[model samples]
Target chain A: MNPTVNNLAFSTTFNAAGARYRGIVLSANVGIMRDLAFNASYNIQSAAYIGIPQDILLQNTNLLDGGQITGIPLRQGTAGLSYQQRSGFAARIDTTYVGSNNSWNRNPFWFANASVSQTSGRVSVGLGVYNLVNSAAQQYGLIGAGVFVPQNYYGGGAFGGPTSAIQPGTEEYGLPFRQYWLTTKVSI
Target chain B: MYHNHGYLLSDDFASAKNDVGFGYTWLHQANTNGQFPYILCNGNTQNVFGTYPPLSLATASYFARDTWMPNDKFSAFATVWVQRSLNTISTHFDPRLSLVFRPTTNDVIRLTSGRAYSEPDPSLLTPAPPSYGSPTSVNCPSTTTGSGALVAIASEADPNLLPETANDVELAYGHRFNFSTSIQADAYQSWENQALLSGNVPISSIAQITVPQHLIAINIFSA
Candidate 1:
């Protein structure tokens, strides 16, 4: 007599995998005027996995292509300018850029921020706005249900599986939209 | 002949010229709700329960440093730091040494080395195993001849996980061009062990399964 058993399982665990990152950073600060200063910086980076196959697949069936490590952006840069007046008033503007790279998919984004504050005696107040342009860009990606489901549903065509069966895929998303706020600081 | 200031109350000893200092610091953190309660699953959608343990853990660290200046151009310093945790990991000891040399008024050089360690996250230290729902069998329709099935998967935590550790060496040089601007350069190399990551383990298998659906569970560990 012959006996047969069927079992399937999916699990995620942590391993001591290795990765390498190399990059260069350039920054400068210039005194545009007596009370005004300008600063800028640029960062360029390249990251790759070590001791792992370039095409290795994760538990979610997503391929780790190009030896790309997760959560590391290849290129990013920032520039800002600040001005301070003798009357205890200061204002600054900053902008940032993130080059497109793959977490799971390509994510390129940009945003700007500005603030103005006035100090009188012991109290300081300011107003600021984030995501000045309100650009819609995906900042992160993941593999999961309802987020990025790699599945197709049919009425038991060939395998006679339920319609809820899932395929393999990834999903991408960005951070919150533009926001504005006010702040106050008191010196003790 | 020597001159004495009122900075010291007792200066009779010859070693009294050396500086002595003492410092103490304390930190207390409490785990609260909404801090880390859920794990992100799939892509962006769907949240899995059981990310953190019900209990709370606290950690404390202390450090002391001493500096000795034998001459006007050179100084050496050493520090010892110790840390202890309540529930995550055992105590850790770290020692560091640094030497600074000033060859000229415009140039300064420093060499330093240290060992550092960090405990794992509370959630990862005590992880909630993934819970897969019951599996259901699907019968082949009139067109197909075989059957299929589906299941959900989750991950488990490792209790024997160790804290991450690293040994680092650094060399720094600084030169003053003028009072308003200066140039500094640093180079460092580090060797790290017991790094944490996620991996998949096959808990079960399926055979003769035409259309088998798998729910993979993952485990956390330090390597």
Candidate 2:
């Protein structure tokens, strides 16, 4: 994490000698009042390199074979705000947006969540939400190794490889990411 | 010697893997001699070190400091850190804290307390596996891949091993130089149990392995 004290910046990423990804970011904060205030910031990142971890691809360039994989997110936005009362009552809503990701990472969608609560009374109850949009989510991807094999000792079928019913990327091995759970908390 | 229909030399090929006292040391790659898949029982050595002697190791440390405060007693600080290992079966989390008190103003002295944590990077302490592995994975290429490197580390997940833990306490003092800018400092410390580290042993290293055709490298080492 390079520490750059900047309010905004423009950056670009290249893939296969082509302008793959580029983006601009905008952010600012101001005092709407004193105790009850508001602040919001948005980022617009567009790049053909959105879903892929390019560094990994670049590192293996010298391997025995080839193919190309890259990700692109046409645009993305993130914004949120909060409201609080001196009475210990507070509420907030947040938005995590992907502006129509046009690449393999998938379709652009926004996820919104909100919460409200008041601790003024004896019994306090808080209700929260997640994945309000319930947009289909992809947790991860499966990639295969190839082009060269260490002589003929053991093909990819070692490590109990083809022998066992277990394969990491296989659908049989549950992918750990997509979800929307409802949780509630009660305090006395 | 060839008269018996066999090419022979004085002790040319000694495939004496059956020697009783010859122990195998765990290595980075080739733990299987490229014979058995990862966990298949192929009569290979259960372990290179064949049950390495319960790994035994130890460490000790000490520190001292002199501090000053307003009441000639306001600024005070002290701390100590120590650890040890025995038979590759050990863990400890220890932290120390101390402070002095002085009253330059009415609100200078403070009673403080807190909980400190020294969890190793889940990746470092334990193995953080990718959801998937490159086709020709050396250690973990399949879902049998690994829950974490720690799982295969032997040092961790040795059913006998316990989750490391630690606890801490603190006390401090400070003063405001002005409204916008001020000087504030605190003296603190803690003691912990089960700090963690990889108990991994290295054996023959992995050479180069490639398979399929689209092979894209995630991490590989080649000269």
Candidate 3:
């Protein structure tokens, strides 16, 4: 029995001249009243690129072929509404959604924001709250080589048993939590 | 490290029914210095560093565009691009066309079609360092060995690869009502050829590796 599972991970650049992509976008805007407005847009696409690894030992290429490319979400969209009062006051709310791809099954997230302001003479003061929903969102998916665990590679029984899986990369959750901001602007 | 220098000249003219502009650009790019780990298989105590070969590439482009509106209801825009890359002794010609029609003050229809060329990254054009033999030293003992020797893979680089090409078309419609509500939709299709991506190919030689294709991998076995 081979006692070694020293797998090496390396990547090289090549020309995938056959990659193709297509998509559609839709957007709408409406003014509910003289001071209130809403806008939204959605995008959907199907992008295909060839980059899956082919195991030479197995002599099989179709196992991972035709899989969707990583990092590109199949569906994404955003919606927002804003209202402005003649008295120098305003409020707004927004939501965003992003679908998943081959690299990961993403969770949809939404956040809201609101602000109020008062203007006197040449000065204005405002208070705003961002990410009112405090939704935790991840920005990037894991698509690079991930860490390897010994137990996962070789089952507890023997070397030929089913091998567990390891994530090839990690995700980045860069969205900030709910926060508030205060501002004072002076006209020059 | 990379360095770039470019210059552009353009002119614009307007007529009763058309707007025309033309421009020429000249650019030179150079990749002067870089070094990276060439090969570092697991349990290999020594990592090999390879030096990058300096590269000087030149590019030139000539472009012209015209926007014509014969009447208030319809308009058209046409553009042509002629680009040359010195590294590859060839030139590319691309054309783009767009048309728009406004049936009413609140409705519009648009169509666009174009072809474009993109050059590969500068590093992709340089050849990788030659593959090295098995390392002379080992830090850890393995549990198995393969064919009484260590087998490794090396990436083969090609300097002669050409630029990728893409074609795209789009159709769009928009409508507005009461001057307060508007809806816009667009459908597009794009295809690209000569896309650049890494692939793997089996190695048939023992003491040496061939070039122009394949990826790098190192397999270490223990005893």
The candidate that wins on DockQ is 3
* Predictions' DockQ, in order: 0.18, 0.02, 0.26
lDDT of 3 by residue, B2-92 (tens): 8889999999899999999999999988876533443333323434444334567788999999999999999999999999977766699
Task: Identify the runs in model 3 with alpha carbons over 4 angstroms from their true place.
Answer: A1-9, A50-67, A84-91, A102-105, A108-132, A137-188, B1-5, B27-59, B86-90, B123-161, B198-223
Off by over 4 Å in 2: A1-31, A39-79, A95-112, A134-136, A139-188, B1-223
- Please, what are the lDDT tens digits per residue for candidate 1 over residues B30-67? 44232222432332222333322233445566667677
Candidate 2: tens digits of C-alpha lDDT, residues B1-223: 0111112122222222211111111111111112112221222233222211121122222222223233443543333333332222343434444444555552356443433333232222221111122223324212321221111212212222333444544443445544322333333333333433222222112122232232111221121
lDDT of 3 by residue, A1-188 (tens): 23122322123444543666888999999999999999999999877754433342122221123444555677888898888888777777777766654223334445567777788778998888877777653444444322221221112222353244342223434356678999999999
DockQ of 3: 0.26
Residue A150 lDDT in model 1?
Answer: 22
Displacement of residue B82 (Cα, Å) in model 1 is 4.3
Task: Give lDDT: candidate 1, residue A126.
Answer: 97
Better lDDT candidate (2, 3): 3
Query: For candidate 1, what is the lDDT?
Result: 0.54
Q: Model 3's CAPRI class?
A: acceptable
Write down the RMSD of candidate 3 (Cα, Å): 9.5
